[model samples]
Target: MKALSESHYWATNKKKSKETDQLSPFKVLVRKEVSDHVHSWRFILLLALVLLTFFASLYISMSNIRASFSNVNDPDHAFLYLKLLSATDGSMPPFHILMSFLAPLLGITMGFDAINSEQNSGSLTRLLAQPVYRDNILLAKFYSAMLIIATLFISLTLLMIGGGLFFTGVRIESQEFLRIIGFSVLTIVYVGFYLSLSIMLSVAFRHASTSALTALGIWLFFTVFYPILVNLAIRAFLPDAAYLTQGEKLAYNELIMDIMRVAPGQLYSDGATTMLMPSIRSLGPMSMEQLSGAIPSPLPLRESLIIVWPQLTGLLAGSIAFFALSYYLFMRREIRS
Candidate 1:
């Protein structure tokens, strides 16, 4: 009777697992990863950091905007909400810039231990022994990280919009609100590029520490050193920059900007700049001929989309390519050790 009871227990568990698999094992894996991230101390620390920057920037912006309004009329403040975000009067970096810098950290934190840690602990092979598919594991990992980022970004954006409405006393245009939404969504995508690359490293490297250090190295180089290198390259290409005519100078600067866009950080900053400040009419330094007769006005949503579409696509493409490469590597990797 005891032997029959054990057989029955195993049979029941097998049936339940089969049903669960049919229901989509990926969903179960995603839920587990999401729950782990939400509860982890690492996530709590990142959340606190995000909130610190979010509120500091928002409060400073409110004070600045209120001060600006002390000397202005009411109707004109309608289109001035963006000034609260973009034009920091020596208090703190703009909300967008702060996010641009810290957002990558969140991605890195979530993804750098995604795969290698499990492998290092010897649970990776056991996990594969389960009913879950291999693709489901990796896909769940990436998607869960993306979902967390999207939630954080959306919440922060709504918080900013609410704070601006209540404290900034500026009338936000409908178009401006839509643009802000688009900007928040694009920021998540930009962060995902880093998240995907970091996960790829996690899969490729044996040690979680090594993968994390590699990711941080890439981030530091791109964020800190790449721009300087790009500038030097521009100067190298233009040895006599001082002797160039204004037209030549503008052309060279545009070339420099185009080359810098190859870096994901630059692409994101350019997109964020264009989204947050619609008054920016051009990415490159504008010649007088181009600026002549140009009315200083905020562009419509459609025009801004057209401007930043390339950057958006680039971020998306980089993320997908890195994910595919990671998937390939993870599949080829053996756990027989």
Candidate 2:
């Protein structure tokens, strides 16, 4: 009896080992997530919308740039590349602003149902039973969505550069190219924060719709009304400050600026504005004392980076914090499906 039991135990252990080693678990999970996103109707529609808006904005901007190329007198037109990407016909926002608004939709759509949909369909239980480690499922979803966003950003960057060259008949300068690259990278980081935020929502809520609406609510608040609300609240607190001295006024403005930076959109827009409009030096309100003898000149790439590094750091921190929170919550979540 002892000999028979020993043989059976070894056989069961070997079978389990084989099951766990059947395939590359991470790749399997990533492939599954990528395939689902690629084939989904929502992704298709979202891609169509992004492309339509971007190319239309690009066309409008190119026309404006051509019309003004003859009048260019900024010594450097230091903003030639940025102008190509952002200068509109005064009828619409720039291409980059349109992108900023549209990108959160991509994040919310891809991530809002990450876990709950699987649970609803009764597939979550089966996925957990697979040979892959449990954490691979969550990581795979994030990495797959990140990969899609990165590819989209890169393609758009190339399209912008190509369009600029073809329309203007001039090669992009090395410095301009680097600045554009930096802008694209920062935009990705900004969008990634939303992606991670939506994923955390999915992990927290049991219903995908709930998570999606919540994510969209947060997005709209930041993009549309957050600053207005902040300004109003500041005034409410300082209702009698309209007659304040110049120094007091400057201090009040600085206080509001710091508060506005709490929103990711504000940080990104401020940073992008500075990088694109090289003439912008101070993010905060500057009195003459602060700007004494400051010439109106375009900043170098290094200087722009130094100015925006804090914003970049904030974006990176937000992305990592949201993802870490999601992971922690997932580890503690009960697998009921």
Candidate 3:
């Protein structure tokens, strides 16, 4: 009887301890992940690359704006040039474009080896031996990657804003500042999408290098090659479609182009245009010229948001869905060599 009672007591204690561990396992995991990331050279390289690219692009853009100002005789042209320099809209200078591309690469670099490295080093087994839950491992790595990406973004944004103030001698309005913040948020979401993708690939592959390369390949496909491929496919499938009259055939061609714009880069380009140019209305079904005739006026911010909301929601939803699938797969995967 005493033996059975002692066994029951020990089992109860073990369960309680596990419950306690589960409650705070992610905290320790996050701390360890942050420490590991800070010590890595990749983090430093990513920061350096982002800063250097930003400054270089900013200098070129400012120089071009200054040259335009000097060459223009009309007062209106000067005012227009100044407005372009001061505006934060979709016509984002080269610096913004550079950062958007760089941000995803940075995210991939930070997360591509997160899980596989631990597995390769045999640390994963030891870590799992602890009372920590498996979900904590994934959550901690994700949060750490996000923190690094956010810090890089904030640092670069401040530098750009400071440079704008120093060179342009214009104070940004509160509303414009808010717009910049909104752009940053979208940029972060873009980065997060890639980071989750990298994590998923990291778990899917055995070698860290393979995982990273796979992520890069996907990035290139989506960002660069995918659009070209899509265009070719469309052209092949719809040869002579563009030469068709501006009636039903032209309408059909436009429909095909709209469907193609579902790709992330095209979607983002359209969304950015709407945000940056008050003159832009609907970007999916109709061109700016067409929309202008229908409204004959600039769209309000609310209307602009409504127009692009579908693309934003779709991209965000796709990212979340992909990550959820990855999480489910990782949780169920066997840890065999």
Candidate 4:
């Protein structure tokens, strides 16, 4: 009886251990993906580049920040922290601008090979053969990448706040802090759009190089060539004529801005500028009546968000659409060992 009772106790302990070890397949996939990304050398290199760019811009912004505070009557007095991010010595761009260019690269780097690399290595087949659902694989990769991105931008935001406090000795106001948070979130959304796009390319293309090059091409077109194309379109649409009325000119300007904002980079820049520069009242051309009575005071955080709602919505929607398309493509594709 004593031996039987001891055996039963050991069996119960073994059952408990098995229960503890039975983690959800989704959780396991997410953990594995996160671990892989955190350990990868390419991710480390890209992270270093982003940090270098951020600190260089921050140094330039901080060094010249005093100029913004020099004028006694300057409206910038109420926004010293905001100025820390936007102010520049003209030798380099501000933090937000540099981030606008670099954030997409980080996103693309994390996701461009998310699936194809696994597929090529034959691990994807083995992974799918486990108890994991098809949806779990794609969702795991996306969520893991997003988790890393969110962690990165949040860390940067905290660092910016701390660095500003340390160097400038200026206490950040509540609204300023909120605006900085909004800017960081906007940047994450911008990066997320690229991440989704890169993931979609990875799903559609078999080779990782093809997906990487395609993502870079899209980035270049949107960042560099798209604006040029928009300018040419504006010129074609609204020719330079002396007889154009005020209303017509305003309409033309609005149309051109709408065309320009179609690019994700423009959306991000417009939103980040609005969040970081509270003095910017409108993103589009203002009529005489609308501008005549408006004061130049810095807007509250709520108003700034209202001004950038369209941009924020567009970016989020684009991210969702791209991820949805990628999910669809990945679900339908066949895999073999």
- What lDDT would each prediction earn against the true structure? 0.84, 0.85, 0.70, 0.90
lDDT of 1 by residue, 201-312 (tens): 9999989999999999999998899989987776676768778899888887788778888888888888988887776767779778878897767677799899999899
Query: 97-165 in candidate 4: lDDT tens per residue?
Result: 988899899999999998899999999999888887989999999999999999998998899889989
Residue 92 displacement (Å), model 3: 12
When sorted by TM-score, best at the front, the candidate numbers are 4, 2, 1, 3
Better of 2 and 3 by TM-score: 2
In angstroms, how far off is 58's CA in candidate 3? 1.9
Candidate 2, residues 1-337: lDDT per residue as tens digits? 9999999999999999998777588987888899999999999999999989988888887877866555555533545678877677888898778777887788889999998889889899898887766678889999999998889888998989988877777888887888888888888888899999999999999999999999999999988799889978986788477689989988888888999999988888877776677777779998988799977788888998999999999999999999999999998988875
Writing each residue's lDDT as its tens digit, candidate 3 over 42-98 gives 888877887776666565557566554464443223332223423332344555456
Output the number of the lDDT-best candidate. Answer: 4
For TM-score, candidate 3 versus 4, the one ahead is 4
Error of 2 at 3 (Å): 43
True-structure RMSD, every candidate: 5.0, 7.0, 8.1, 2.6
Cα TM-score of candidate 4: 0.93
